[model samples]
Target: MSETHNDPLARVMRRYLRRSGIIHLPVVYSTEEPVVFTQPVSDNVLGSFCSVTGTGGLFLAARVIRDLVDPDKDGREKK
Candidate 1:
């Protein structure tokens, strides 16, 4: 098994998504590059909730701040 296969955050996220009935995407990781995973919502209810609540924007801002402060931690770049 690869080292990233045992990543705690990845494992927790996978479990949570599974329990919530979210479709899981392939896990990609790299030490020299950033990894991004995108998932499509198969249910209209969840999609509507996400759009109405503006959860995506909130998540984007949080991620931007996280990356700006510590780019290496989350493998994201600061804008």
Candidate 2:
């Protein structure tokens, strides 16, 4: 048996991965280059929101903001 097979943490992680149905290991790499954005964010961008219920709340807020900013896209006029 390999050294990894004998490791307790490795065995546990492998079991967890198998139970989670993850067939392939993730590839991770490090880069020294500075990050660059393709497009700058607009000044009209909405401020971040903290939600108790996670992504669902954030998605709802985004939908409402989109409608408010461009109601014509949704075929409605802003009040």
Candidate 3:
């Protein structure tokens, strides 16, 4: 019944929140502020991946750049 209820993005967001069990009504959301890198990215930090569950999982990000994850090489780091 409100003007914003007619917005397409508002409708989509409401549906997603409902499906995801966040809320049954419209809620306020905001985008995070853009970050400006103060330091140059190093190769050591570039290809690393982190665990989504934060525990109890294999860490492959650190092994990627070092070529340690190769299945044909029997998971040995390339020299």
Candidate 4:
């Protein structure tokens, strides 16, 4: 690629990765409830965010756990 041609190091790494059969694609994150997290997962696409930060990851985890705890669509907490 033209971009890689400019940098020999990048070009080498790209070639190596290709030969290694590794997917090097930009990771895209998605969610319905305010997706505030994002991360780079090698070259393959991830359905959910592979957070690299503690805060965002923790928040997302907490949200999922909390939602699972209730499992109610009417915003009612489980007793």
Q: Every model's Cα RMSD, please? A: 14.9, 18.4, 17.9, 16.5
Per-residue lDDT for 15 in model 3? 73
Candidate 3 lDDT by residue in tens digits, 1-79? 1223435676676677767887433222223333456999767763323543333133444444335555354343488
CA-lDDT, candidates in order: 0.55, 0.54, 0.45, 0.51
Distance from true location, Cα of 34 in model 2, Å: 43
TM-score of 4: 0.26
lDDT of 1 at 66: 72
Point to the candidate with the largest lDDT: 1
What is the Å distance of residue 31 in model 1 from its true position?
26
Q: Residue by residue across 1-79, what tens digits does model 4's lDDT show? A: 2223344555677788788887542211223343344775565655545554556667567656766897564233498
lDDT of 3: 0.45
| Clashes (N, CA, C under 3 Å) per candidate | 0, 0, 1, 2
Q: What is the TM-score of each candidate against the true structure?
A: 0.30, 0.27, 0.26, 0.26
**Model 1, 1-79: lDDT tens per residue?**
1234545677687777778887734334434343343775355434234453576566667767777898768543497
Ranking by TM-score: 1, 2, 4, 3
